[model samples]
Target: MEINTFRESNQFTYSWHAIGAGLLASFVGFASTFTLIVQALINAGATQQQAATGLMAVSIAMGLAGILLSFKYRMPVSVAWSTPGAALLLGLGVVKGGFSTTTGALIMAAFMLTLAGLWKPLSRAINKIPSGIANAMLAGIILNLCVAPVHALAAYPLYIAPVLIVWLIMLKIKRMLAIPAAAITTLAVIYFTAKVGNIHAGDIMPHFILVKPEFTFSGFISIAVPLFIVTMASQNIPGMAVLSVNGYKPDAAPLFTSTGVSSLFAAPFGGPAIGLAAITAAICAGEEAGADPGKRYWAGIVCGVAYLFYGLAAGAATRFISISPPVLIEAVAGLALMGALGNSLMNALSDKENRDATVITFLITIGGHAFFGIGGAFWGLVAGLAMTFFLRQRQLKAA
Candidate 1:
């Protein structure tokens, strides 16, 4: 897809569908998980203001990064907050040195990601990880979220059924619109069932609040290392897979470096972490975005613009989510991610040679256990690859 062709095609003829896809994907990605992010920040000892600032920073950073990458490469590249990283924070529940120290850890993670992008040996090592295991790790990370709708329906049948029904109908009629339909249905249910006025909107306006970094040995060991590992193994690897499956071949190092730079700037502002988006990027990269791949970059641009606006409203949005029942929001997010989870599982299991290893990775990750301050994702990769290596060696000996 040439830039000239993008320019010549009716001035890019702006595929509104592409733009819509981007907008929905971004909205779902943010709305569904922002409460968890806020909770993670607060649990890390951040004030509410600081948490909101973090959300704004990551939203803006990802938006701008997505736009720049899309325009520069003419690919539907999207960036996002690291969901797995946030989950890691949730599990940490206030590090030894508090929020400032955690911020330092985020900066360190960003620096490590930047190095991974710039250093050949590191990048090659990352690339050498079996795709099956990487995909499995991501799948395990998201599997819980994907099943939320069912749990929601079981618990709040009347409240959740309508949304689930809409999502299923949309999935049958128009696959790309399924999640959007579910989101709309969820909103409608909330409007009728819950008092709109009760929804909090504390300080609706967005404002920046910086939390200076305070590095510590504990922060680095517990927070920084795990964040970097989860971001790389769970987000970036699958993100690259999304692009590859969509028929775009991009150099991974630059993308990693760029997101690291964005995260570096965002860290001081309370952002947990940022990375290439795997699930939402798939939304923008798919056929629903557009028939012509050349023009698909417009989807990412529109998504970026949407994210910028979302950031501006982060304060209000976070407040509203805080007021809403957590289960409902998780259900919406789960619905949005079902497609992605299914795809990841398929990819993880597709390679027979790596099936055993991938399954090991998936089970360990889904187990959601941590040891020695390291998250399951890291351990999952280690276990899976070790099994894979051992099995390969055994096969060679037998042959």
Candidate 2:
């Protein structure tokens, strides 16, 4: 009888932990990237309904996949929409064919991701990139998010100050609850300030919207190729590192394969490109989840459930944002990404040999410069490699 009772107790505890971790992970994960998704959809020429569909599709797929994978692995494996891909989509899809272009690119990218997973040689090559360089790249990619809060403060000093104070207090006092505190404080400040100013409220419910996808050759060339490159280099590479750092040795093939499949499934629905999320995954894998590493799986599960809820209320979410101050979002996202950005920078510049190349990569990436219709990441990497090769050739000649 006592053994049975203990088993039941253990199950309950696991379930609860998973739920809590999932919720925290999902909130932070989505909060970190959802705006970028909206921007991408908008750039892709999606209608309001289509945009909502994209958000919902992404939320559902990420949530379900994250939950299933975490549960299967018995570890936290949180998935997220690919922010870098979304940024690429915005630049490429928005100006060209819009929704059609975006969908076409998504399909193509998914295929490429699948191929990458299957091609052992290519995967191995990718894995061979110096860990320090990869870390640096990841940190550089996230640096903008950390800086955004300062931008937010500049924009709305009156409204953001109170929330920032609350966030700092929570950080110092109740560290685990810092994110939730920032969110709540931001919302409160927005509401009261808006009410006092008599600003009209935005719509709070997501509309039921559907966008049928159409594929095109041009779309594949312009959008798909770039999206594929960025997702692989910027998202998946860093995501794997996060898991590794946490002592979870996940098989890379399944992880990449799952993301590809999920992206394919989500394309028609309205979600921005879905991929592995490095930053949020780190949070789930951290020591705070529990003493037992296995218990962290619950965090992924919780994040999935939250995604579902967010998807269902997409319309309402838009409405809430309409009256809400932009500073609130900026501050929260910036604060959330601070640790990630710091970690990435430290890793990127750790080795003296790689420092110059990594700095070049970071500048090119953050500079937003593109070449031949491709985005910054591809060019940044190219420039870095070119410099590295040149230096190596010089050394050989001297020898």
Candidate 3:
């Protein structure tokens, strides 16, 4: 009887561990990127109300998706709005067509994602996209944002130094915690230094706003295509790999389909894109969540619940970001994305044979050199692929 009681007690501990892990995962995920999401939306031409609504919608979508996947699969299958996708938006900046057009682009991208799940050929084609080119494009998209710290340091050293210093300290101790630590530090900086006019009661709770989408060829090619590519290459594919590594391999089709479908629901509300997570998913699926792998679903469920709460409280986050000095929030965001940029550069330049093509892609993207209304991301991929094909043909002729 004592042995049995001990087993039950042990199981109880594991359950709580899962719960705690889930909350941490959700908090980290939200705090780390919520500001970026808002910034990206505003850059894409969303008004403050629309940007905050986008955050709320995406946060809720992420929560609901996590809950659905975890409960059904009995695993810690975490979901998140695409960080890289948001970065792509930031890189693209305000398109010619405006926020409604960006919304249309997002809806189209979500549709393509859903199709990728349902259609085997499309999925295979997307998966087969050269890692070097894809990574190079991602590296290019985020390259500028990654450098925001240097500029921010020069501009607001007094206010930003403490945040960067604390982030640096945490980076050595706990890499994952570093960004959130920076975010918290920024909150402190904002609270004490910045003059944010009175945050009314309504400012603490975000309200949903419907966005009417307008689709155009320019928006579709510039925003939708690149958004889908990054979300798939950087987030969705790696997200599945993370779960597989953690010994929880659910069907990728459902993951894609569900997130894509969920994104459709959120896009009208200005959500950029949604997909499975790469980093935070590992947290919820790892053994740290629970010893019993089967019970790790609790972590996912709790993470989802926490996301719902964050969604409701998104207005306060937006309020702080709004009052922040220009380049200040980007500084926090840049610090947060350093790790991703590092990984992307490593992957993009890893292959000696592909270095030439990869460099073309990276330079064009990072340079933000565009052609005829299209953005650098679209042109970078094109130029990279062309260079890759031409070089391969030359090699074949020589051989």
Q: Which candidate leads the pack in TM-score?
A: 3
Per-candidate TM vs. native?
A: 0.81, 0.78, 0.95
For candidate 2, the per-residue lDDT at 248 reads 78
Worst 10 residues of 1 by lDDT: 1-10
Query: Which digits, one per residue and each the tens of the lDDT, describe model 2 over residues 301-363?
Result: 787788888887665444444466654565575676566567667777886787888888878
Query: How do these models rank on lDDT, best leading?
Result: 3, 1, 2
Model 2's alpha-carbon lDDT is 0.68
Candidate 3 weakest ten by summed lDDT: 1-10
**Which regions of candidate 3 fall more than 4 Å away from where they truly are?**
1-14
Model 3, range 124-158, lDDT digits (tens) per residue? 98887789999999999998999999999999889
Candidate-wise lDDT, in order: 0.80, 0.68, 0.87
| TM-score: model 2 vs. ground truth | 0.78
The true-versus-predicted C-alpha distance at residue 184 of model 2, in Å, is 3.4
Candidate 3 accuracy as TM-score: 0.95
- Error (Å) of candidate 2 at residue 40 is 4.9
State residue 135's C-alpha deviation in candidate 3, in Å. Answer: 0.4
